[model samples]
Target: MPSENQGFSVWGFIKGFGKLLIGFLLLLQGIIGLVVMLLIVGVIVSVSDNLAGGKAARVDVPKGAALLLNPQGVLVEQAEEVDPFEKALEEAYGVDEPDQVEARDIIRAIRKAKTDERVAGLVLDLGGLYAPASSASKLHDIAAAIEDFKTSEKPVIAVGDYYSQEQYLIASRADEILMHGFGNVVLYGYGSYEAYIKSLLEKLKVTSHIFRVGTFKSAVEPFMRDDMSPEAKEANLAYLSVLWREYAASVEKARALPQGSVQRYADEMPPLLEQANGDFAKLAQRYGLVDDLKSRPQQLAYLKEKFGADKDGKSFKHVALSRYLKAVGEAEPDGEAPNIALVTAAGVIVDGEAPAGVAAGGDTIAKLLKKAHDDENVKAVVFRVDSPGGSAFASEIIRERLLELKEAGKPVVVSMGSLAASGGYWISSPADEIWAAPTTITGSIGIFGLLTTFENTAAEIGVYVDGVGTSRLSPLIATGVGPLPEVAAELIQQSVEEGYERFLRVVSEGRGLERDYIDSIGQGRVWIGETAQGLKLVDKLGDLDAAVAAAAERAGLEEYDVVEMVEKLTPFQRIFGGAAARAMKLAGLDFAEARAHQSALRKLFAQIKGEIELLDSFNDPSGLYARCLSCELR
Candidate 1:
């Protein structure tokens, strides 16, 4: 016989234990059911979507009139149909991945537009489009193809509300440029804006110990100084100058404007607009910047009247890029003949193999270069580079391999994309020639590294560290531990100086500039293509098509097939790699599951783990590297 209080306690414990067990079992069953339902739904949705309407809709374009839409953002290598579940997950997570427009798709659209008998004219809508340089390079190629259409006596119309200097450069090649009735054009030019973190950290009572080698290595300056270093400033100016020259020249040739006229037109705009009574459209017409000033509806009406209306009253037979591409056959490699390899070096520079949606890995690119070099049928190589630079060693490895390709008798031409700066420029330096767009961001000849210390933070938190080491630099060598020793700092500075010297040497040798002359502009600097040409960093001011033409001329080929150097995944890779990707997505799902399964205790632990994983991934690199930490637009 138990007392009443003891009986009550025993009963409560039993009830609570039973409730937890039952809840656990119910939760497990619910998860199982949910997973099965999700799988079934996913399979059904995938099948239905694939089978809907039998196949993709196709559209036909008329000859001599082409519809051009500058679909710019992130470039997707392949555009796969979106899964409903993935879309839902993305929406729930507030993750808006950039929509991808494939290069091949754009090329196909241009080819179709050029051949279509109904397409008597083309319209380029250049508004709200900010693409990577590599993407712009491809766009420029497509524009050139459109120019070929113009040779057939068809006109290309370019329309923009407000034009950045680069946008104007692209539009300059159009047969007619159209500006809005109230739009303003501002060509303020280009400059580098690096974030300085030293002062920011100082305010937080945090210190950073920087270690790097490269005279132009300004990457670490943000951590140590409030402004750009002297070495960085010098290198940046020369590189930017070279970029600007390239840009201006490209625009000049494309627009058929005389020397200094582009600048003159830009400078005269304020007064020109004022003279037109503030009517931008009238002003543009007066300056020959535009042929017509019309509203969207008016333009559409004009187009309809010119090309005839569809049954729905829509002007002309306008085809979307995807449909047009489907109508035009994909470019296939000619197995019996030699091919010109177009290798794209886009995205961030990282060590090892790159995952999807990031810049390629050095090892991966090296392998591709080696393969292209080995292929005797690959008569010429066009390196399409659109990058902001990355690891110093990786850049050198790529540059060295490219030099080897050139040595092997392959005419290697570099086509600068939206960005070709720092390491990007380094790799391009060894090319036989470099082609850049007027607005292309190029030539950031700088380097940097950062190591943050948490000694003060630990002390403030009442934490202390005790360690024994054989060398004075041992403890300081680790990150977030303490300040670097003086000896270590000196060694790092010397290493940076040596790297800067080597950087200048490479540029000097490659660009035909003397060491002293190169050094004069060798500090870490940034430039647009127009500025770079003035400094002679770029050999030619043109787009990717121009680069291909140059390569063909160098290779002495009157007709050569353009073949992209893309790695074809093996069947095993398709199965295992896809499964791996699926697993990752599932892991993310599992994280959500764990949160839902347990109480706040489990959620906190999971979140901490996730943060650690992210940090670990960021720190997983080999050798010295300089990367823009905040720029992850794609």
Candidate 2:
């Protein structure tokens, strides 16, 4: 074993040194962490005061600078709650997730920039924009604002390397759209696709027990079958077609093309591209979808010619949307003005508390409503819902709070976002008025329960779970490890049926419709906004602003300020957390693992993993869900 030929054992020396260094670093990290915690507690109060009065951190607007409309994140009704320390750590290691930009923030910026003398023009740098098919309403809202901005007689130019379907929707509103010479403009209409895991579960010797009501309630189909059921397909296609029609119509109207031009462009792409000798840019121009094609440098030169140059003369004089918002600051309400509290109930409905932009925790939303109920200044509430639904129990919890708010004599208006189905509809039922966009997906009024057991898999590995108990429900105790008993399964099915009846009753009472009629139209069917209005599911077809105005009108407030009600952070969390994270990074405590950028294959796998993870996150106490899995648009 002795290496006589290996004179210095260089490899062994390096290995030994690496181990020693790692051990030392681990020891040092623990000591440093302890000290940092103590130091944070000591500086909490002073840091809070400084942060409260800090004007140095604010960004300033340059005189006559163009407001660069460059949003770099997913457009959300409300941003998720982020821990500053965790965010800093992610940034320190360069693995932070994309930022969440609020739709309201973008609208506010556009509205403010419309009249601001310092803002001379608008630039659409939307190469990083990623709006989902479900966000058609929000996209239209932003595009409408851009149209309104044009009335101020300031130039609006959209320059990008390429434009995605959603990105092009906003770019179409600009006075000029410049794309890269080699860029392509493709438009893929709406679709709903999901992984079917029934065969995979069978191969793994796993059993999936699904309980559901409604012929169109296909949320559990991925476990029950390898393909979408006819009813599910019919319902999904109906809504998807509506959304696509709306999308094509909007783009056509904005670009001033014929009514069916956008549809023809998408439909005739192959032959059109062949005619253009495979030049996507030329084909786009030929079809009148874009203005001109230029490279990045040429685009920059063109912008500089329009808006003049910056002090350095490298590019145009403009302030990014993020920085521009910072300079403008948030608008505060006038003293004693009646307030219309806008509360966003986004994400899946879940029990207890949850971070913003995550699951819509029943308790968290209820707490927000409770605050609105307690505040005399808040005359009405505009509840924005963008969810595909989740836990039935959690939905009821939120619905009860809305009822309380209504009982308190405050008008509650529900503004449906991209999707407000199943449990999303449940919470909306209690509102005095429900507003939805023409493309909004809603009315999945159904309930389902699922339980996957590993009994067969355990048996395959020579393991078994068996026990004796006091009653027939004894086998249910080990349901995860043993076979589910017939008696227990029957009881669970009965519970699901009861839940469906309760959902029907809730809708009937909320909408002032007969229970029989509600169930006739219900049966877990999904409907688009326009169709839903005809079906009496929604009162009006409109956007969030319309809903806000309706809430004000109901409250009889001639002059009122719209206020976004959000969670407040503690003094310590707001200041010390970020500081501590930065300090730790500087101290060489680099514990974050480096994640490589995702490839196409990796993204596919991630989608599959997300579906499984979503199933795992179902934590309803009743084991019942009012979710619409088929509601997602592609």
TM-scores for every candidate against the unseen true structure:
0.73, 0.91
Q: How far in Å is the alpha carbon of 160 misplaced in model 2?
A: 0.6
Q: Where does model 2 exceed 4 Å of error?
A: 1-57, 574-593, 596-605
Which residue window of length 10 is worst by lDDT in model 2?
A: 591-600
- Candidate 1 residue-wise lDDT, 1-634, digit = tens: 4698899999999999999999999978866766676566656655654665324455555443456556655454333333445555556555544466665566566666666676666667767455442344454555567667677666677777766665665677787776767775555444556768777887776877666544565656767888877766665565454444555666667766678755666668777668889876676566655667767776667666655665576555455455566566566756876778988777666666664345656777888888899998899999988766677777787888898998899989999876777777888888888898775667656555555677777677776666777887776655465655677777666665676677778888888889888766545556557667887888878876789999999999987888887665432333334443444555575456534435557557666865574344343243345443212212
Residue pairs with backbone overlap in model 2: 80-356
Which 10 consecutive positions of candidate 1 have the poorest summed lDDT?
625-634
Give lDDT per model, in order.
0.66, 0.87
- Tell me, by lDDT, which candidate is best: 2
Count backbone overlaps in model 2.
1
